[model samples]
Target: MTHPEAHKSHRAGWLRAAVLGANDGIVSTASLIIGIATASATQEYILLAGIAGLVAGAMSMAAGEYVSVSSQADTENADLAIEKKALENDFESELDELTEIYQTRGLESGLAKQVAQQLMAHDALGAHAKDELGITDTTSAKPLQAAFYSAVTFTIGAALPLSLAWAIPGHLLVISVAVSSLFFLALLGGIAAKIGGASITAGALRVTVWGALAMSITAVVGNFFGVATQ
Candidate 1:
């Protein structure tokens, strides 16, 4: 009999970082452009602001992802090191620990011990790491990968709004950016959710609604400042 295919939990690491970075890039850059346009800023100034936001946002995403994921990787490595030492110092207890874990997962006591013995004989540290500590190969953290994906995706997403700002006239810039940003946000949300096996409509609405609110607030603030300065 054929076994069922495994789920895509392995993609969680980079997919989540990339999607978040892209969404932030689109929303934040578009909002910045819309805000500046609403404030009666010149087209040149608006485009410059968008470019600045894109560059800053991408760099921030990269740095943030790298630091956070690196911390996680460090912790995982420390835990594995501790577990390895434990296995060397107390092999019997480690084997019993694995056996208990299997038993908790519904294996019979005798069978659990037998299975644990076999696994320990084959790869003791691997068995402990996977079952006891929940650190598998797929879930192992990679800081560089996360950082690269986040920065690249952020740049790509930010470029969309910047391109529109460059092409659209000043008079219509705010509305055009607001609408287009929402569309892109919704699209990205749907695509990311689909890849992550979540509800598409929910994801789309979630990002679009928040994106609209963000743009709306920024526009209002810009208009208020514009009028005050005038």
Candidate 2:
């Protein structure tokens, strides 16, 4: 018999970090450019600000992901270690525990015991890790992978706004960057949601709305400060 299609939950870990990094990179860099441009800052200053934001933001995302995912990994390892100790100290209790866990998941008592026995015989730690700890191979955290994807995606997303800021004329810099950044955010959000098997429209609209708000606020602040300075 054929199995039905599986959900995309496996992509949860990296997809979240990657999407967040990209969204922040685009929104923050674009907002910075628009804000500086509204302040009547020179092209050099605007570009400088975007570049600085891109670098700083990318580094921050990377470091944050690494630390957080590393902590998760550590916790998983600790739990697994405890389980291993318990199994070694009392195999029967551990076996019974596994059987009970399966039963709770809707298996018949006899079937649960049989299945647990077979699973434990095959790989006791693996069975316990999968059923008891809910730590499967797909959902396992990888700090380095998270850090690398976050930093790389952040850099790529930030580059879009920075490039527009550099190429667009001064007279049109603010609007151009704002529009382009929103477009990128929407696209990224839709793509991320689609991959994650969610509503594309909701994701796209969510990011775009937030990006517009951020840029608008920064622009207003910049304009106020510019007029005040003058």
Candidate 3:
């Protein structure tokens, strides 16, 4: 019997975008609602603010993720281009570079050179790209994919608190949204950590703490502003 290993590193690109989007959506919208509700705003006004935050946050996440990932993609492309030219101009030097990389990774010199020769014979540019530049297909940047994930996850995350705000009433709205959003944040963190092969408890605690702090600070600010206005 042969065993195949499964790795989670391939999930890096989309997972990062999704986690960030969902986390931002929950924290920002929840904080916004909690702040407004704490200030004694009308339910309608609070819900309206939540909706606006959700829409704005989703768009911002999409655009920001797209642009940021696009930049990384551009950088990777530029590096690949330079590597390609270097290979075209100095095949021997590039071959030696790849061999040296494998040697440093613990292969004997002769074995390293042979391995490099075989890899380069099959695909010189690919060998150099993977070994020297650290660019692999699994880890390559995808702007559109990142943007889509971020936008969708953010909308879903923001809806949680917004719906809670709508369903709950009075001063209780603030407390309810705060508590529920923290739970959502913790759940999200744990899920992300689990998928990424990290400690779920640590992840959950990390996000929960930050979310609680965010809501608390927003509540204080809202209370202050509400008092000052009155």
Residue-level lDDT of model 2, residues 48-84, one tens digit each, is: 9899999999999999999999999999999999999
Question: Judged by TM-score, which candidate is best?
Answer: 3
Between candidates 1 and 2, name the one with more favorable lDDT.
2
Residue-level lDDT of model 1, residues 54-127, one tens digit each, is 99999999999999999999999999999999988999999899999999999999999999999999999999
Clashes (backbone N, CA, C under 3 Å), per candidate, total 0, 0, 0
Could you estimate the TM-score for every candidate? Answer: 0.97, 0.96, 0.98
Model 1 alpha-carbon drift over 4 Å, by segment: 1-3
Candidate with the larger TM-score of 1 and 3: 3
Off by over 4 Å in 3: none
Candidate 3 has what TM-score? 0.98
Off by over 4 Å in 2: 1-6
- Write the number of the candidate with greater TM-score, choosing between 1 and 2: 1
Query: By lDDT, is 1 or 3 better?
Result: 3
The TM-score of predicted model 2 comes to 0.96
Models ranked on lDDT: 2, 3, 1
